[model samples]
Target: MTDTYDVVVNGASVAGCAAAVLYARRGAKVALLERRSDINAHKVLCTHYIQPCGYPVLAELGLIGELEEAGAVRNSAQYWTRWGWIRPEDRVGPGVLPHGYNVRREVLDPMLRRLAASTKGVDLLLGHTVNELLTDDGRVVGVAGTAGGERFEVRATLVVGADGKDSAIAKLAGTPSETSPNNRFSYFAHFRGLPRPEGHSAKAYYLEPDNAYVMPNDDDITVISVLPSMERLGEFKADLEGAYRRFVKALPDAPDIDAAERVTKITGTVNYPLVVRESTGPGYALVGDAALTSDPLAAVGCAWAMQSAHWLADTTAPAVLGHGDLGAALNNYRKRRAENLKAHAHLIADYATARPFNHIERFTFSAAARDSRMAEHFHVFGSRLMSVPDFLSPWAVARCSMVNGRALLRPRAQPVHSGERVLTGQGAR
Candidate 1:
């Protein structure tokens, strides 16, 4: 038998590092490949908002405290719905994943990378670009790539593609993925010296076709961005800074981007449509954005990246190490990935269209904003911790109905008919 590792992971970002570290901890010999020169290299064009759903992985990896010490800001979520702003006081639910985090990629990327490099039995191979997959009998057995300008090969029982949205591994492995059109484009820049907010809360503005999001990161800096309908892409392309300013200023409660200095120039390339790929095959699997990437309008990408990696490791590690059935392990990973994310992805894709919220949506948003219970459910739903059906349960629907129905009952002036005029009680009698 040719010498083989338990697993070989391509890419060394959040998803790749998490899977590599966890699998190594489970006593598996793992190889982690990175195209970059160093594992600590930072990724640009990322919002870095890891929602509540991703908290457990941070905790499980024991990095949450270190991140907090590194000045990671824990934040709750708020949205300026069309009717009004929906502010949830804090993240709900008790046991785990109680609060989300806002940490810049500059801080997070290195931390995850270092942890993986330090883990026992994991080889962190840097500066390697996977040129092709090695297959036998129509099943992937390993990968052949280049490192230091020379070809290299790593054989493994399982291959993991965590190379992000534009996955080279998926392309080489002949995995099928669907790309959905994105009706919006995003623009973002970081600002320094903004007046300190009293509490940590990430804010999102819903302005029909145009939307804005703002969050507090470390170093007293804030990240703010706008998602304008794709129809305005050409307009933005013509004058990027001016278009960005216009959208920021249009926020119902606009931030003072004018007063604060921009730390980085407005950053982004052309927006790509959402992509979803199947998670498993005969000998290879995908994790994170490589498997499923959707609109970032709701800030769910980072969280999902952490989660999918953790889930992949949890299911596949035992089988890869000869403790379980490989087929069943792969299937479990696939189902869990789909069951947890399918509905959330649907909602994100729908919102990516940049369409105005309809009446029912408006009512629900308004109601969720007004009541604590509704706000709690909204918090869970927004964090991708709850599905649409789970969030809009019959009881929840009834509550929204009651709240909106009562809102309609507030007194309003009745139009006076023809010649009739208002009269005092005494005169009428």
Candidate 2:
């Protein structure tokens, strides 16, 4: 059978669904195809935290209030460094706005799919797998797919490839991709009755080289994740639950994650390489993990995915409405994404390869922990509020360096008294 659509989107996950909804809302007839038979398909391996920058997009979609109404808990970021716990600075008011939502993917994915399916002008086709791109004169015109033993062809002016990191459309379009040796694996599971730290919404304990993140989501549940390099994958995989418990217990001022009741079985994935690729072609574009993926250590994937979807929608809406060339539109989309995220990619890449707490990281972390102002800057940088360079600029670094120098230069002296330890300043002889 043959069908027609203004835009045919492959992969009905968050990115695909968002694309379809945005295009449909702009009055374009969109056909959204999903290989999964279930509309509520869940990504088992995600941390499922969205940054504050993404709230604007959700609000624009009219879903932020709905999400809050649905019990999504707001969260701030806390880093458990060797120096101490680096909470958001007082100057920043709270870390919650920058780091944002703690929601489950199981809840989020289904809600987005339902929104896309219900949007006007969207035709959702579940359980259909695209086999090949339909091209005409070197330009992608549509797609050919198989659904339930029946072959179908969809002809559209524009095709969107939101099919994720291993996007078939990106491969078919000959878009070159760069896959780096992330070599890191993560194991995570949900737990109930985990005692969340007071005034700290989420905690990331960086135990040098490897780290564990504890994110408190709705319904008294917290997600605990540990990311270790491939060399340690076997150790973790051999006994996932035990390894997770050991890591959490080892943290300074450790939370009660070990004591928390397990609400789900422990899950793990190894050697999950980070991928970044060109996301546009003659008549198509990619979004979400389909466009680029970074180390999940930063917990920025979901936000980036949704933001990229919004960018694609905004960029292509005019072209789809006949105001510009579709190819040009897609190229513009690629340019925007690269401009916005390339620096972040470089930073993450460096972190993945660099040995932990080298001279530079130690200097930075120590400085930030001592001064709330510097901590605020660090928090903003980590939360994606400011660019990497901006956070690491000479001025910012100088301010931090000064504080660190003072902390280092304090006089060495005897203890204040027996059984009493001075945390920062030196005492008299």
Candidate 3:
């Protein structure tokens, strides 16, 4: 069978579905193909935390209402560093989404799939896998693949590779790529009745070379994840659950896991290669993990996936709609993507090496823990709401220096009485 459309998108996950919905809403006919046979299938190996920067995209797609209806939790971010807890004051700059959402992929994925399938001008093709690109004189025209064991062809003006980190479309197109090794491994599980984090916010423990997270999500479920450097892999391997539980129980203001019932088996990953690829080609483009895969520690995968889809559509739609030159538009999209993510990606890659905080990182993080203003700047930058240059502005640097210097020079508190004992442990009794 043969079909035609304005755009044919491969891999109907977060990026693919967003691309389909956005493109179709713009009046482009789109065929969204997914190899998965089950429409309700969800990604299991994900933290599923969307940063605040991505909330606007969800609102633009009109999914925020449904997401909230499905019990998505709005969450701010707080960090526990050696110096102290760095919790930003809830401050929203003009036009900035102040908080992020915690929606399990089980709910988020199927919700988006259903949305894309039902949208006008979008043909959601389940059980269809693109096996080959249909090219005309070195330019991609569409794709050829099988749908439910039957050969199918889709001829379109543009093609998108939203597949994933291991994107078949990217491999077939031979996108230039580079990968960096992750020096850490992670384990996570969901629990019911876990005590709410303070202010119901997301808590991250920057335990030097190791890290942990407590993310409260929909349906009163909370996700606790531990990411330890590869040096501790042996300890984790000896007893995964034991080590995982011990790590979680040791966090500052740790959740009441002993009282909470674990509802899911432990899920762990040993290696996650950070991938960066050229996002555009002659008649093809990539978004989401297909274009760039950062360390999971950054927790920006889901957000960046949707944002990249937004970028792709906003920058290239006019050209795809025949109002402008396509090549120039694709180049424009590439530039926009780099301008937004290149520095951030570099920072994430460097941190993924499992190194302890450098002098500047320690100075800034400690200062943030002490000063709410600096904490807000740290939070805003960490949330991916601002650029690296903006976060490290001269004014901000000067302020951080002053804050850290004050914290360092402050006199140590003297005991009220000689018999007074200072408690030195994490969490409450």
Ranking by TM-score: 3, 2, 1
User: lDDT by residue for model 1 over 125-163, one digit each (tens)?
Assistant: 889899899899988999998888888899999999999
In model 2, the runs with Cα more than 4 Å from the true position are: 89-96, 358-360, 412-429
lDDT of 2 at 246: 85
Q: Highest lDDT: give the candidate number.
A: 3
Stretches of candidate 3 off by over 4 Å are 90-97, 414-429
Root-mean-square deviation of every model? 4.8, 2.4, 3.0
TM-scores for the candidates: 0.93, 0.93, 0.95
Model 3 per-residue lDDT at 32: 96
Error of 1 at 122 (Å): 1.1
Worst 10 residues of 2 by lDDT: 420-429
Clashing pairs in 2: none
Name the lDDT value of residue 309 in candidate 3. 96
Q: lDDT, candidate 3, residue 273?
A: 87
List, residue by residue over 260-291, the lDDT tens digit for candidate 2.
Answer: 78889888777677888878878888899888
Q: Which residue segments of model 1 deviate by more than 4 Å? A: 1-3, 90-97, 412-429
Q: Between which residue pairs do clashes occur in model 3?
A: none
Best by TM-score: 3
